[model samples]
Target: MKKYKLILFSTLSLLITPVYANDNAEQLFNERCAACHSINDNSHITLRERLQEKAPTLYYAGNKFNRAWLQTWLAAPSKIRPGGYSFFNNVNVTDEGDVIDESKITTHIAVNSTLAALLTDYLMAQTPKSDLIALEKVTLGKINRSLGSKDFNKFKGCGSCHQDEEGYGGVSGPQLYESIQRLQPEFIASYTRNPEAWDPKTLMPNRHLNDNSIKKLLNYLNVISQ
Candidate 1:
């Protein structure tokens, strides 16, 4: 399977012309990603825009994603959101609550390693404007597994819907442990501050958490993921 994927990736490389080989990542982002993504902070986005959004904003993607994961994901697109950005759009009403219409779902646009690398670098630089999440202070608030586990499950009650371990926790939300590898510290910190600021329709609640609490949570996520 690995060999097959490699072959496919290599085949994809042949599609791009050498004329645009020296293409700027920022230019590539504007031309390729802008249609489906917002590269701005989106502080002024309206409720209608929120409901109509097709993909997540890239304004703070750098703060939210691991560089390695970004590179891999860009090169090989996969479905991260089981329910998708908007389940109502992609799902059909059946006897079941709602079943995703796999055929109507759009896949991510893939690029070769060169473009992916440059794009990843560009994407990583798109950090949030907020200076509230002080890296130095955040680093100091690191928590241990015992404390983190309790906070994750009991205090936050996050385990009610999110996967805790291999077979534990609820399946409604993404696995927090896996998220540790995929997300960046600053993004989590910013999102926790106000989930609606990024995505108005996001399921994540505005926990009204303080900077210190978020920093500790970030530390806990980092520790457990490692």
Candidate 2:
């Protein structure tokens, strides 16, 4: 009878452990991350609210980010967007062009390894767009680096906004050299295909890229990230 009781207790403990961890992670996220980032779905948020946001929404983090990268990034945060989350806030109108005031940008809050792991686990479970992510079918095809670079920089004009190499492109958009490491391939494809579908108030234009173009771009992103 004592043996059976112990077995039942062990089974219950195993089940309850995950719940407690989840609760703790949620509490930690609320305390440390909620001020800058949002875990709630903000698709219906007003344009003014979206423009005023301090950081990117994490409600679809599970669908968007690579788990390992997210974990590492949380522990040692870096600037993904050189111009800051709200680009308008960091840009200065100059005689040459609109220049990003790098001094105005702030780095993300870094957490210790334990806190990062807990936060990453919690954030990775918040996948509201699992269906959308599922719809994207990505195939890894080999693309020549030179041709890909030409297409990315000259033909497609992506270099005008995104950096395929560190400190080598415009600061208005998030750096793309580490995109494959940071973001899921499907999320990249989906966002590139239609930026407004993901963020209604996004500054990214709808280029209406075909599936072939997206695949080529994905291949290019993969090569550059590596």
In model 2, the Cα lDDT at residue 149 comes to 90
Clashing pairs in 1: 64-184
List model 2 lDDT by residue over 55-89, tens digit each. 89998899999999999999998889878888888
User: What is the C-alpha lDDT profile of model 1 across 1-226, one tens digit per residue?
Assistant: 9999999998767743334444577777776789888898675777677768887778877767889999998999776655466655766777844555777667778998988898988888876644534442445245778988899889987776565565566444556676666876666676677777656666677779886777777777777677
Model 2 pairs in collision: none
Model 2: residue 9 alpha-carbon error in angstroms: 42
CA RMSD, predictions in order: 7.7, 9.8
lDDT of each: 0.72, 0.87
